[model samples]
Target: MTDDVTAAPRIVVGVDGSDPSKAALWWAVREAGLIGGVVEAVAVWEYPTAWYGWTPPQAEVFDYEKNARRTLVESIDRAIGPDRPVEIHTRVVQGHPAAVLLDAARGARLLVVGNRGHGGFAQALLGSVGQHCAQHASCPVVIVRGPGEASND
Candidate 1:
């Protein structure tokens, strides 16, 4: 295991408004506080587009970024409480969740994620986004599994 003293590790956590993810966020915040590092809360959202075979409305439509930002903040507030010593940063990206998280993990000292999310069956068998990060991230990855959620892999 890499010693925590090697660097004041920056923790990246992926939140998708799921109970397990909430637990992950809570864990990340506590771990970041313990390590005296910052937490980057990331949410990946993709707007419906031609690639997905969805037609765009003529008028200006929904603001996915704004909504994602709000969700990230709300999740952090719900998990870490309103006032905490941990520094939290929110980022919303447009792409696949696992890919985006892996890219974000490049500069992060550690990547943290839940064992499962809103994604159901595929994630369960594949070990979710946390497992993907653990396998591919440049930095260390931590998988925070929630209580009562059986390990499928």
Candidate 2:
């Protein structure tokens, strides 16, 4: 009888240049290594002027997709080591973070995200993106809480 090994499940994690997102990236790498699966680091960045009340003369001025993609790739490369065999992919989309992350989860076995993001209230609210992803992602979601997350008494 021949023994067959099943490939590890694919994992998707969202990153937005925040401390919590960085923590999630680190956690995702470790988990991916343990499971022998690759990690997809996703960053969702839309044209900044669209929702900020600034009408740019040229749409390209606020287009952050390329920069965001590069940031994610570089960050993953640095964190996972240059020679490691871990497979990582980077994607940048123009849309809401939650929607983008949820869509990416369609083919993934697991979705990982930070408990907080760069846009939420500093005191007591979980980031809207994380909250939405946790509630609606197609796969199991893992929310990596940051150091600033408070513990319940």
Give all TM-scores, in the order shown: 0.79, 0.80
The list of candidate 2 runs beyond 4 A from truth reads 1-7, 50-63, 81-85, 148-150
lDDT digits (tens) for residues 14-102 of candidate 1: 99877777898899888998978888899999876675678677587788888887888888878878797788888899888999999
Give, for candidate 2, the lowest lDDT window spanning 10 residues.
1-10
Model 2, span 1-153: residue lDDT tens: 322246566889998877678788888878988988888889888765555678567844543777787777776765556775677778888888898999998978789988888786866457788888888888999999775676776
Prediction 2 TM-score vs. true = 0.80
For model 1, which pairs clash?
none
Clashes of 2: 0
